[model samples]
Every structure is written in structure tokens, then in C-alpha cells.
Target chain A: MNKRRAARRRGLAASDDVMWSLMQAAHAVESQLEEALAQVELSGAKLAALTQLVEAGEPVALGELAARCACVRSNITQLVDRLEADKLVRRVDDAADRRSLRAAITPLGRERQAAGAKKVDEVRRKLGKALGAIDHAALKRALSDLD
Target chain B: MNKRRAARRRGLAASDDVMWSLMQAAHAVESQLEEALAQVELSGAKLAALTQLVEAGEPVALGELAARCACVRSNITQLVDRLEADKLVRRVDDAADRRSLRAAITPLGRERQAAGAKKVDEVRRKLGKALGAIDHAALKRALSDLD
Candidate 1:
């Protein structure tokens, strides 16, 4: 274990330090990712929504999209509206459930998502270089373990 | 090395998967932190600004605050405006540089920062339990090492 981790484990480090470290680290990584996304005219939120639509591989119900995005339905509606305006996504009637509408990725959306994914990977590779393979694996594992 | 990292290292894993994992992890932790901060009527941006002011230990120029927060000066001004409205921070003429204004934390800001810090620690402890001390340390270490 690193000296700092050992100290934390031994209760020698203050709680504030740990919390500050976590926040700083998250913010730093996020900033880098956000900068990269900005080059493609995408914010983190927009990229995340596009990624979700692409992953679904079909039209996703507005409610389902909100749930997956961890946002309110109204917020999803606004987001979808923006995406639709950009021609990156389209709202269509749900064939399986006529009463509902679903958001589907357009070819443009897929293209933008692919571009955004590339940018994200570039940042991750930079992170990997800074963190090394072992630490990178450990971070991913640890984050995945969070509830 | 874990299978995923090994795959990534060998250029075997799809970039989309790696990107998705990173975003998901960051979003999950951020959501938890945001929820905790909400109890104190502070968003993440407000809390970050207040924390920076408190850490400075004296008034900070708007430019410096912008740099520290990784935002533009105008954005910092708006943020400080809200904090000032809330009476958590106050604007003071910079004695060292008469042309500029600086932001200083109020007594209430200190109290709020302390309270917010406490809530952040509580979440960290919960994270520690979920991740275990070792993995938690690794994750923290990895994140710190990122560029």
C-alpha cells in the first residue's frame, strides 16, 4: 500500500483530506473529459445521453431514458428536444406501445456518439499513461464496486 | 492486470466500453455527493466555490477564483453573486490591487463548508465500506494520478 493509504487505514489521515482528494481527483478527470468532448460540440450530459441511446440499439421510451440517465422526465424531455433539434435524435411513436413515444438515434447521432467515444478513449488513454496499468485496473474495479 | 485493462492495453477492448465505464463510475459517485450537498441547499458548484474560498484563508481575486474553479471569470462572478445573495460570501475591494474585487468567505460560509465537508466524509465512509479499505485506496490513488 502507498504511504497515504497506509496512513488512512491506520486512521492517521484526516477525513477531510480523503474527501478532498476524492473530489479533486474526480473533478480533474471530469474536466479533462469535458474539454475533449467540447471539441466535438458536445457536453458531458449530451454525450451521456447519446451513448445511452446508442447502447439501447433501438428507440428508447422517454421514461426509460430518464431512468437510465438518472434524471427527471421533464429534464429528459428537454434534452431530447435539443437533440431532436440538432437532428441527432428523433422522437417517434412507440410501435409496441402506441400510447408512448420513444427517442431513437439518427445516423447523425450515431456518428457524433462514435466521435465522442473516440475523444473519451483518448482521454482515458492519457489517464492510463499517468496512472499506469495496475492503478488503472484498481481504480476501475473500485469504482465498479460502488453501490 | 485485470482482463479489461489488459484488453485495453492490448487495444482489444472497444473504446466505447471503457468510456462508458468511466462515465458511469463518475456519474454514480457524483450523484451521491450531489444528493448529500442538496440537504445543505448547496449544489456541487456552490460547494466547490465555498470550499475554495475557505481554503484560501483570505480574500481571493475573481481571476484566481476562476482559475481555481476551472471556470471563466463571468461564471465565477455569477456563482459569487449567488453566494453573496445567500450571505455565504462577500465581495471586498482587493487592498493589494485596487482595480479588482476579491471574494471572502463569511462566517456562515465556514459553517456551511464544515457541514458540507462532514456530509462528504459520511459518503466517503460509505464508499470505503463498499469498496473496502484497500480498493478504496487504490481508486483514490489512481484518480489522483490522472492528468
Candidate 2:
């Protein structure tokens, strides 16, 4: 016996159900966010990238952006390519390290990112209110523990 | 403002974070379980199908098994083919519905499922105890509200 199966047989609670429900809920929310961002031609990953750029207040190295997104370097390359093609971002050679490149959000990207962020903010608020009605403290505690 | 994103921004207890954590945890558990199951030549999905068949105690239709597994019928077909090749499961003609085929877990499949389930149960218990320090009801409630 490893771990989860033991928990299931003991009937402490259906660990599988707990885990599955969590995945399902996350997937549902992610799908909803993707749909919401579609109008702005952004995926959740793209939106998250833009947000990172906004908070940085300056162009960040491609590697740094990828790390923040928790995605692969190749994936970041594709994401940056799409954003750059849309004129929402630009990749410039790093002045300090010529071999390294930095990604900067364009003025247009800033406006678009701001607009999309408002929508994201609204969605988060509703989720908070609903979760607050349940067990807000517990949820917060779990997240804090993970970090 | 879609529902989830707003809640995330508010920094109000985020069901999203809880959900993400749960998923990450589950993936970790699954990877561990698979490491053991690999010795028996079974993947998680195959093991799940075998378990379902054992629980049914009779031939189970492919479509029904697919639904139970939350997978597409085509995926089930491929899985069944692999299982059949391994002689762990077999496809039998449905007497009532010739158009459909019933999948039956062989004696070997049942034994494998039991052993796998036991190991999985064990791992799950440890996981539950580890997470026991956290509030699960709060997590469940927050996840439920998302629906």
C-alpha cells in the first residue's frame, strides 16, 4: 500500500474523490478563464505572462518570465512569439548581456493587459465571495501552507 | 469579471489555489503509484478499468466504463485493446445489445486490481494523514461552490 488507497479503504474520506474534485474544479475554472480571455485573444498563460510583465514595470529576461509562469522555455518562446506578433510585446536584446533577450510589453499590450486584468479581477472576486461563504479561512490556510 | 479570477485577485481565500495544490498533490501521488504499478505492466487508466470491471462483477459495456473513467470512448477502445492483448481483460458480445461489447476483467485482472488498489489505498492514507493537519471540509466546501 502506498498512501491514497489506504485512505480510501479506511473510509476517512474518499481521497480519490477529494483529489478528483479538486482537479475537476480547477479544470472548470481554467476553462472558464480561457473562454473569458478568448475575446481578447489571450489564454490564461498569456494573460498571466502579461500580468508578470505589468508588475515588473520593465522588460524581463525570457528565462525569468518562463520561470514565473512555471512553464518550459520552449513554451515561453511560443507565447512570446504570439504576443510579439500581435504588437502587444517586443523582444529586445539585453543591453547587459547581448546573448540574453528581454521581453517588454508594448503600449498596446499594456492597454490590452489592463483591460483583460479587470475581467480576471472580477472573476476572482466572485470566487472569493462564494468560497468565503464556505470555509474561506481553510482555503487560505491551504494555499499559505503550499507556499 | 468571471467568477474565479476575481476571487484570485481579491486575495480572499482562493479555491483556485486550494484546487491547484490538490491537483499538484494528486499528480505527485499518481506518479508514485505508477512507479509501483509499472512493475505489473499496468497504467492508472488500465488499472481503473480493471477495477471497474471487477466491481461490476459482470461484463461492463465499453461506453459505460468510459463514462466511469471520465474518458472518451475512443480512448477506452485503445485501452481495452491493450488490456485484451495483455489477457487481463476481454471483450464479450452483449446478449441484449449486439451493437455493443461488454468488457470483462479476467481473474488475473481482478488480482492485479486488488493488489494495485491496496497499494493505492496505503499511499492515500499517508497522504490523508499528511493533509490531515489541514482542514479538508473547508477545501471540499470551497470546491463544491465552484459548481
Candidate 3:
């Protein structure tokens, strides 16, 4: 097994295994969340953007929204476009800075977000129950170290 | 903070935080790997399929490749199409089983996979160094539980 040991020391084999596990775990969590979001007819991306609007409790500038979403301004533009097409959000000219544009959540957006959150919470609770025996505190710590 | 406590009890806030961290950590690792793979003109999906072929050390059925890659057969079909377009792999009819298709790696495929592995190993080693302080054994178990 010296070959395996050498590969491990080179951070090849062991790291590959560990990294793959991390990704698979993340995928498991994401897939459940995706399913829950689908029930509400909201994609993970759409819900994320809508949720940001809900949390802001007011219109947010497109640039600021992009920053908050950790997405590029161009992507945010397209996302906002989709949200607008869905009638969940609208593009409003920034009152204070006419040159800037902002995204405002419509009533439909808030309603949909609340629905999506409810569905998402069900999956989260199920997840917590399923993983309850797993040391969440340790898992949380380990995940943070990755970031 | 009663709402916060109630939310935690319901497994909403805490799970969301933990789950979000997990996805973000996965993203961090994935982003680094993606950037590295891009250097060799390889996407993660392509590399994963190519790596599977390399590990098999022989022509493998497309269905088996899908199973190994944990991808849908339909998705694998598209992926193989792209790989074939890149001239990394070619499809050959399985002799023992008529009407069955298998993927055989080309010499170029082997060469590219070796090159890709070298680049990937560099990132994996860097990941190992960065996460060296963390408890890998515990992390691996926790992640496996997720799957």
C-alpha cells in the first residue's frame, strides 16, 4: 500500500476522497432544498433574490443586491429581468440617484417568498431531524473552516 | 430574541445557517477546482467523466460510467458527446454485446487526463494544506452521513 501512502502524502488520493465527500454532502443538502423550492415554483436563485428583498423590507439597489448575492452585476441584471418577467420584482429608478436602478419586490414577491420559506423550513426541519444524531456543531465548524 | 429562539427550536434559523455555510464551503472548493480545470480547458464535469474512464483502465459501458459518476444516463450521453467532440474519448460498440455502446479513451484522452490530474493534484494539495488543521476524519464521516 506504499503507492497509496505516497499518493496520500502528495495530497492526491485522500484529499480527493475528502473533497468529493464534501461536495456530495453539499449536493444532498442542496437537492432537498431545490425540491422544496420547486414546490413553490421558485428556483433556488429566484427565491434567494426574493428572500433578499423580503429581508431588506424595502427596495434595494441593483448593485447592492448583486453585492449581497455575491453575484456579478451582469448576472443580477438577468436575474432581475427574470424576476420582473415573473412579476415578483420590478425595476424602479433610484429616487435619490436617478442614474441608479433598484429592484423592488411586489406584493406577489413577498407572498411567494413567504410560501417558499414555509416549504423550505419543512425540509430544513426534516434535515435537522435526520441529521440530529450527527454533531451539527462540529459539522458547522468544519464547513466554516472551508470558507 | 424570543422569535430567534422559537426559530431555532423549529430548526429554521440554525439549520439555514449551517446549510448555507455548507453550500458556501462547497462553492469555495468547487470554484478553486473549476478555475484550475479551466487552465487545462477542462470543466469539472468533463474531468470527472474522463477521470472515471482513466480509472477503469479499459473501455467501459456508458451506463456504468453514469453510475460511477453519479450522473443520469441522459446527462452522461450529452457529456460523452462533448468529450467525443473534444476527441478525448470515442464510442465503440461492445463486441460481446451487440447494440451496446462503450466509451474507450483515446491516447489523447489519457494524455489529457494525466495533465488534468497533475493540475487537480496541485489544488488538492493546496486544499490539504489549507484545511490541514481541521479534523479530516470527523469531517469525512459527517459528509458521508449527508449522502
Candidate 4:
């Protein structure tokens, strides 16, 4: 029984190592991207919000924006306030629900989002070159499966 | 020339899609881990600091800690203050450098670090299961190469 348990522990450790490596890689990539975004007066959070809005192709419910940003509703409100102040996004009354609000990207927001996306692509391209040996198709397949 | 530019744009977009997917995957995994760490009263930043100390196996200078944590010196000071308040870590004058202070983990800190590591491992295991179809060895190789 002790031997069996030891074997199981070893297996778990190996698995943990892989997960740790992935986390480190993600953190490194994010740190680099954050620095890049900062040059444009954008943060990872703001970029994420803008990215969601652009992808949404229309105003999204405030609650849905919060969900997509993986942030609390109050935090999303503050974020939207900043974005609105920058004239990158605007809030509108929900047509279907009079009491609710939605966030839509303004033309300026779209322009900024495009610029941000370009920066992200540049950074990601560098990362891809760095990890060029990896099978990107396989990686994409795996990530898609997770979703 | 226009056709070539359009084709290149298409290629870049496809590449961007793959990169975006990876970012989303990483975000999902990190969010889950952050939630798990919160149950132990540890934010991702604090946990990162603790992990660094544990790995160093000795006291780490405040400036070095800031660099490792990817924050400013003042930020590290505040973070260390919180950790000290919790009695998980302490600050001591650097023996090698009298002008500097170093942060070290206490017995409680070590215990907490172990607990945090366990929680991280558990969450990572779940992520692994979610991406069970991926070639983990290849993924590890790719990430390690990045470093």
C-alpha cells in the first residue's frame, strides 16, 4: 500500500510540474503584454474589456461584460466609467430591459481596440517565434477543447 | 500587391486567433486558481511572493522581491507588511547588505505556503484534466523553451 501511494504521489508531482510551467509561461507573456499595452495608456483589464466589446459587435449587457471580463459587477461599472471618460465606450439603456444598461464601443473605441489588437499580435508573434518549435495547431486544438 | 496584402492579413488574423485562444485558456486557469487561493486568504500576488521566498530557501531583499513580483519597491513593502501582519513572513536587516532589508518566511509562512501550493496543485490538476487531450510533455517543452 505504501509503495502504491508513493507511485501515485510521484504521478501527481509530474502533473503539477507541467501545470506550473504553463502558469509561468502565461505570466511571462502577460507581463510583456502589459508593458506593451501601457505604452498606449491601456491596461490588461481595459484591453480585455475593449476586446470583448469589439468582438461582441454590439452593445452588451453590463452583466455580460462583467462576466466576460471576469470581474465583479462593481468593478465593471468603474471600468466602464473610465472607458466612457476616454470616449472609447458609451453606455446605453437596454432596449429590451428599460432598467438595464449596456456598453457599446464607440468609433474611437474601435480604433483604439484595433491598435491594441495590433500590439497584442506583435507581442504574440514574438512569443510564437520564441516557442516556434511547438505545434501551434495542436496547441490550438487543445485550448479549443478546454472551451 | 493588394491581393498579397489581403492574404497576409488573413494569415495574421488566423495566427492572432490562436494566440487569443491561448490567452483565454490561461485566463480561465488563473481565475480558477485565484478563487481557490482566496479561500485561504491569499491573493495571487501574496501567494507569488511566498512562492518566491520558499523557492529561494533564504531571505530575499526587498528590491529583489519587487523585481520578482513585477511591482515597485513601495508595492512590495506594502505586500510584505500584510504578510508580516498575518505572521506568515518577517522583514529583517540584510546581513550581507546593511543598507537593505530582506523578507523571509516564518514557520507559519512555510506552512501556509505548503497549503497554498497544495491548493494550486489541485486547481492545476483540474485544468490538466480539462486539457487532458493535450500533449503535456510537448506543452512543457514549449513553455520551458520560452524561458
Candidate 5:
């Protein structure tokens, strides 16, 4: 009556193992990156926000930050609150729109972002070395396909 | 002094792009899996715990479950509480030690886990097919190295 069930592996299928391996590897890499960012007192989201501000070279509207961050206004509000508390970013009145508020990265924010990014790079390089034993060309192809 | 920075690409390095591709692919696959599990009111963590319980075929000690789940005991406690509230699991006093508690899977939990596992398998199969163009043996080698 349930031949499929009997035919199935005791725990997971081959695809499941492959998928789980991908998640596990990502988690491992992310944890290391998070640790590197944490040393600079910056979380991933905070750095991302600061990066956008630094790239913009001007304050970005809260609404725009929300859109770029792929989050809602309230979450961006809370995230900005955290960033503001850290003195890494400041909320300023938008000259373009008086009613709106914009986020600008402080000098310290730029410094910390730079430092955190370097740390992240170091970790990535280390990861690259650790994963270097394999064929990078093939790995890149597999990864790009997942995109 | 700034030669390294100048040598770097505008945004990310080759290694950074590779690392990011890994994260992006993992995120894409995980999002698809999460969407499938959401229909059964099960999260990755919830299903993980349920799967352990179903496999154990008996109540599992909280501490032991935490160790098995690679989480702290307190996190396991809260997770168990959530599972209990969802009627997927119940807490029972451990016979070996009355002060400690163990988690037992409900019949409903078993049914849902079976269904959820089916959905996960389906998604994994789809992903496998999507990625089937690549050599799985090589990919598996790369993934195993990440471990």
C-alpha cells in the first residue's frame, strides 16, 4: 500500500542531504562573518544601511532605506533607532521633503563600516583558503546556477 | 598604502562574490523550503525537533534534545514550550529523574511531519532538477569540504 514509504531512505533523501549541506555551509560562513562584524560593534543590517548611506554620499530617505533594505517602514525605523543610538547614523530632516526624515552616516559610521568590511573580507579570504582545496571554477559554476 | 583598495573592484572582490553567491543560493533554497513548511505551521526548527522525536520513537529528555539540536538547554525549553502549545508535542516528567522533563511527539505531530517531509522532499527534488545541469558529485565534494 505504501511502497514509496518503504523505498524511501530511513532519514532523508539524497537531495535533502545536498540541500542541508548547502544550508550548513552558509550558516558556518555567516556565523564567522557575524563574529567579524560584531567586533566592530556593527551587525550586518547596520553595516548594510551605513554602506548605502556612504555610497549615496548623502542622506537617504527613511522610505528609500526601507525599500533598499527590503523591509517595512517600522522595521527600518527600529533599525535606524539602533543605528542612531550607536551614534553611527543620525536622522536628519529631508531638504527635498520637509515632512520626511533621512538617514546619514556619521564619520564614525564610515570608519566602522570600513573596518567591518575589511574584517568580512579577511574572513572571506580565510574561507576561500579553507575551501580552496576544491575546484573553484566548478564551485563557482554551481553557485552561479543557484542564483 | 591604498594600492590594495585601488586594486579591489568597486564593490566586492572575486572571493567576496563567490562567498556571496553561496549565501544567495542558500537563501534562495531556504526561502523555498520555509514557504513549503509554513503551510503546515512548522518552522525549520520545529520540524527539526519533531523529526528527532519521531525518529526517537519515544519521549526525549530536554537536555538531551538541546544537545542533539545543538542549542542551549534554555532555547530547547522555549522550543518545547512552543511545540507543546501547538499540540505537536507534550512535556512529561522523566521517569529516570522526576525533576527533569522529556518531550513526546503527538500523533498529530507525526502526521504533520510526514506531510511536511513530503513537501520538503518535493521542493528538494525540484531544486535538484533545477540544479541538475551541474555535476552533483563535484558539488557534493565541495559541500562536504565546507563541513
Candidate 6:
């Protein structure tokens, strides 16, 4: 907290301060990650989707993609559209569900994802080192609690 | 890491996986905090502003608010505008700098912030306990390095 800003306090609540700190910390982490990702012209959302596809090992239905990403179907559609525009992803009709569409990563998309992954890995190692052997299971549980 | 999702993998990049995990973790934390704040009809942005105002101990200019929140001036303007409409904040022209506006939290705003703070504290404590202790200096250094 900046000293000048500290002077403006009227009736500060402790819990709010804690919450604020958590958010600020999260923001700090995100901004750093975004800057790193910007080098590859990828946003976190785009990277997240690509990562999902890469991890999925095969073509995934668009609706399944949305569910996996914890985002809405419409948002997934828009994301896929952008990815397709970037030539990072392609939409193929689902053979099993004609009503649904499958999104598969293009070769170029995989390459981009690989490069982005390397950069992100560097950032994450730095974060992990900073956070220090973070209890990932605990974090996962807490996150699930939130969902 | 669901097997179903993992089965779709081409060849998971270590860094990409780490980055994705961090983001998912952060998103989980944010969603949890947001849900708690939402109970009082306060979005994360609004709660952040309110928390900053309460912490400031006095009226704060928009620029200062933006700095504390690590957001853009335009975003701060919009957030304050909404906060003012909710009667949670009142804008006062800075006597020293007429061009800048100061936002003061109203009594209602204080109350809401207080309520938000309580819930936030509970969540933080739970999360902190779960995450274990994070090295403040290392984390701050890492965040600053990324910035």
C-alpha cells in the first residue's frame, strides 16, 4: 500500500483489506502472465482453449470444450471463431453428434501453443518458485469449493 | 487433469500445463471471492474500490484509486460512476486539483464494504490455511519482476 493512499482511509474494514490483498495479488499475477503471453499475440483465454485442445489429444465437441473450460457455449463459439480466424483451430462437424461441432487444433495452432507453452512455463516456474511448493491439491479443493 | 481430457493430448508442454493450472487455480479463487461479494451485490471491481476508499482513510482521487486497484483510469471512472449510482460513493472535486475528482464512501458504502470485508476475511483465512504460508517478499518480487 502506498503511503499517500493510506492517508485516505475513513473506516477501513480488515476483511475487506484481506480480500483486497488477495485480489491485488491475483491481478499482479495475471498482468505478468498477460505481458508474457502478449509476446506470442495470445491472450489467456486463447491459450487456455488451445491448452485444452492440446491436452484433449483428439477432436473435441464445441459444447464439451465449453464445459471443460467452464465457460458458456456462446463464448466458446466466439473463441473458436477467433481461433479459426487466427488459423489456430478448425471446426469440424461432430460425426457422432451432427447437431454439434468439433474443434480441433490445426498444425499451426499446435506449434503456436507449443511456443506459448514454453514461455508460460518459464513464467509459471518463476511463480511456483515464488509461491514455493504450493499445496496444489489444497488449491484445487478450494477452487472446487468456489465452483 | 481428467483422463478423458488428457486423452486428447498431442504432447503436453510442461510450461503450458503449469500455466493452465495456475490460471485455473486463480480463476477458482476469484470465482469464490466474487460469489461471496455478490451476496451483497458488489462485484469484484466495486468491492475493490470500496475497500480502497475505506483503506484510504479519506476521500481519494480517481487516479489514485486506479493506481491502488491497478486498473485503467477509464475503468476507474466507470466503476466509480456505478458506485455513485448505488449511493455507495459521492464524488467531490479536488480543491487542489479541480481537474480530478475524489470519491468518498458513503455510510451505506461503508456498511456494505464492512459486510463484504467480513466475508472476504473468512474466505481468505480458509484459503490461506489451505494454501499454507506464501512468502510475501518472494511473491511480491516475482509480481514486480513480471510488471
Candidate with maximal TM-score:
5
TM-score of chain B of each: 0.81, 0.77, 0.83, 0.77, 0.87, 0.79
lDDT of 2 by residue, B26-141 (tens): 44565776776776676777787887777667988999888766678999999999999989999999989889999988888888887777766665566556567776665655
lDDT of 4 by residue, B5-60 (tens): 22122222333344555655666677887889888888777787887788778999
In the range B20-131, model 6's lDDT, one tens digit per residue, is 4434445667788788888988877787789898877899999988887766899989999999999999999898987989999999999999898777667777776655
Interface RMSD of each: 7.8, 7.0, 6.5, 7.9, 5.9, 6.7
Q: Which one is best on DockQ? A: 5
The digit string of per-residue lDDT tens for model 3 on A31-124 reads: 9988888888888788878877877788999998887666789999999999999999999998789889989999999899889888887876
Candidate 2: tens digits of C-alpha lDDT, residues A1-147: 323443232222344444444544565666666677787777777777887788778999999888766678898899999999889999999989988999999999888887787766566666667666565556645533432
CA lDDT of each candidate?
Answer: 0.71, 0.69, 0.76, 0.73, 0.75, 0.69
List where candidate 1 sits over 4 angstroms from the true fold: A1-22, A94-99, A135-137, B1-23, B95-98, B135-139
Q: Per-candidate TM vs. native?
A: 0.73, 0.65, 0.81, 0.73, 0.87, 0.73
Residue A72, model 3: lDDT of 86
Per-residue accuracy of model 5 over B25-95 as CA lDDT, tens digit each: 78778888889999988887788778778877889999978776767899888999999999999999887
Over B1-147, each residue of candidate 3 has an lDDT whose tens digit, in order, gives 432332232322333456666777788898988898889888878887887788778998999888877668998899999999999999999999987799999999888877778888887678777777778877766667665
Model 2: DockQ vs. true structure = 0.20
Q: Count backbone overlaps in model 4.
A: 0
Question: Can you list each candidate's DockQ?
Answer: 0.23, 0.20, 0.28, 0.22, 0.29, 0.22
Candidate 6 i-RMS: 6.7
Segments in model 5 whose C-alpha atoms lie over 4 Å from true places: A1-16, B1-16
- Candidate 1, DockQ to 2 decimals? 0.23
Candidate 4 structure, TM-score to reference: 0.73
